[model samples]
Target: MGKGKNKTHEPKNERQQRGANGHSARQNHKHMEMKYDKSEKMKFPVKLAMWDFDHCDPKRCSGKKLERLGLIKSLRVGQKFQGVVVSPNGQGVVCPNDLEIVEQHGASVVECSWARLEEVPFNKIGGKYERLLPYLVAANQVNYGRPWRLNCVEALAACFAIVGKMDWASELLSHFSWGLGFLDLNKELLEIYQRCTDADSVKKAEKEWLEKLEMETQERKSHTKKTDIWMMGNINRRGNGVQSDELESGEDSEQSGLENSEQPIEYDALGNAIHVDSVKSRIMLSGVSEDEESDFEENEKPVNYDSLGNLI
Candidate 1:
């Protein structure tokens, strides 16, 4: 009986220790929140919720991992989670690169299974505060170099980074081995995107990042010249490339000039170009009827104009 009592006491103590350890971990998570604190301190705006796009395997899934970490939760029993609901629709709010937008609607990442993306019911599960993350390169094993292919955690990390809580993103990602790798692959572009305040700015940053990436790729491929360089050379040889609109306008002007040139000009004996309108005006001023002017068609002579501004 003594031995049995001792054995029974062991698990209780063990369970207590385990509980203590869990409590410590929870405390650490709170400290992490403090560690990533901002001056304006828009706290980690998102309270995560899994949309469960497809039935995921209970053993091996990111959603399960997030549940283990206590990253997925809701404020109330049935209400949507604290953050905005992420959506792929182009109309959603842009990820808050600037502090003002963040305050209005902290970001959200739509949880979807990449393997069965088409199967997800995006329209049905979406919420009111629909937000779209800006262009981001995925560095996961499944979707490296792929834009907008982030898994649940990666999507949250991106929102954290965009809202200027990069440390928070890094800490959350530290839970997995490849988490840091994602940051490394996207480090250059993410830094640039974080600085952008709006969607248009984010787009410009994406272009700049792609251009730099292409240049680096070219440099890696045996020092070959870039297509842009060839284009520049051609432009320099051409002096100036006429814009399409300007070319069209010039063509129209030339065509009208050609049509006008068809009208025969009667030059004055003094070798001056006679104005057709002036001839008609003088004819009208001198009271020469259009009937009287119809007689000579073959040998048309220029009408002489006097200094008095009348046809002589």
Candidate 2:
């Protein structure tokens, strides 16, 4: 009986000790998690932020993804930020000259549906430095290849790229699978933007690029028109059983002859015309009249078959 009691007590003590160890282990794990989370939240070069309106898919929202990845922090609707705010209605364009301001204050972009821009509280989201991104092509899945339709991540990346923070931009983009594509899509334009020393210079560069694009588009359309005309001419020649080269020469000769010959004031479908050879006009019947005599006299010799009723 004594041995049985001692064995039972020893087992209970071991069980209690194991329970204490498990609790301490759990506490340590939770502490490490909290420490890790803090580090993740603090990990970033420049303070990147977003004003998420929750108008997008949580899975596809780049802003939310950045927030999850600890690359960007989220702000409330009326939160005031003293940094470069990229807004569609911004008065000035972002440029490399804003680098100092961005580094000191940070950069932020509004995360909302482009189709619902009106619903966004723009006035409430105050910022000391509100600016617009110059012409840039989106590389995200939602608005890929579209101009000025960047999502949160792409917009933030553009802000970094324009402010001469390529590393920070690259870092933000690296979190996304299609991030590098944004840089590639806007490479030329971004280069032009970065070279700008001020916002006005950036605007000027954008204007020049737009003009060049328009000229190129117009030239392409003009070339297409000329091609269509050439094809039509070829098809017409084929219908006439005439080789294209021969048809060209024949048409040129015919045109030159028509230009050199006397033009008719009035003509029929069969190219018949009445020339005014008299000083005064004469009223004539439609058939077998003085007009017929004139036509026979001009085109052929008079046939003498009235007396014999035979050929002459």
Candidate 3:
């Protein structure tokens, strides 16, 4: 009976050892295959891709896949892209494999990639991309409350760099919110401004930027003013107290003056003759004719006499 039990246990042990060896062999085979496949080309699509610089999860990036594609290592912040109208969804200048679509808006979509796009002139994109740089920088800084601060200064610096006009940048920086992370930039711009050899040229560029900023500000103000006027009109139509009081006060003052003038006048002293004459002259100057003045005098009545018997 003992011999029979040993035989059974021996077979079971041998089977378990065989299973373990098979598993080890498979793992070794897989490792060998990986070593051999090291030179294999990475898999990536060849087409245009879109990316949202504003929000992208970096962990989702497939580094091996991106390296396989002939994509640049970096992309400009605030870059915009559109799918080719003719090419199907993600097929065009930007390879689609390097990015995954995260969001869609109208004709455009957002994707994620570390690949850089070809540099294009700001004017080539109709200044749309140029306008986005400020906001993008602000977003990158993670301080939206002062979005325009550094952005405005950076914009001025960029403009100056492009135009070769330092004074223009300085002047533009002056108008920006100084307290909003702009002190260092402002100082740098001032240094540039001081080094400017062509003040006139810089001045012209400064004027242009100022005019552009002013125009934008004016448009915003006009829109705000229109809204305020609409609100005020609505309130006035509903008879708001402030508007009502202003109107009421004006009417009351006019009526009071008229009533006082209509009351009788009596001189207690001869010295008041100049004052009365001056009043008469003022009325005549206001277009009351001599005949009208005489009518006014005749219509006027004496005041009540005082206890001293003198005319009050």
Best by TM-score: 2
Q: Compared with the true structure, what per-residue lDDT tens digits does model 1 show for residues 1-312?
A: 111111122345542233211443345345334433431243334445555432344344554465456555311112343345555643543544444544564544544455655655455555565666667777766676798777767877776777677886786678777888878877876787777777677777777877887899967652332222221212221223433344333443222232266443332333232335555632332334555444432257546543233456
Could you list the CA RMSD of all candidates, in the order they appear? 22.4, 21.2, 26.2
Q: lDDT-based ranking, best first?
A: 2, 1, 3
Residue 240 of model 1, lDDT score: 34
Per-residue CA lDDT of candidate 3, range 1-312, in tens? 111111122355543233211333345335323432432322112222222222223333221122123221111223344322111122222112112220121112222222222222222222111121111123113243343322223432333333334443344334334322443534443343334434344444445655776899998875564443322112232222334344344443322332256444322222111113354543332334567656766887523233232565
Candidate lDDT (C-alpha), each:
0.51, 0.65, 0.31
Q: Name the runs in model 3 displaced over 4 angstroms.
A: 1-200, 232-312
lDDT of 2 by residue, 124-243 (tens): 884978888989999988888889888888888899999878888888898899999899888888988999999999999999999999999998876564443342222331122434
Ranking by TM-score: 2, 1, 3
Model 2 misplaced stretches (Cα beyond 4 Å):
1-42, 229-233, 236-312
Cα miss at 165, model 3 (Å)? Answer: 15
Q: Which structure among the candidates has the greatest lDDT?
A: 2
Query: What global local distance difference test value does model 1 have?
Result: 0.51
TM-score of 2: 0.64
Go through the candidates in order and give the clash count of each.
Answer: 0, 0, 6
The residue pairs in collision within model 2 are: none
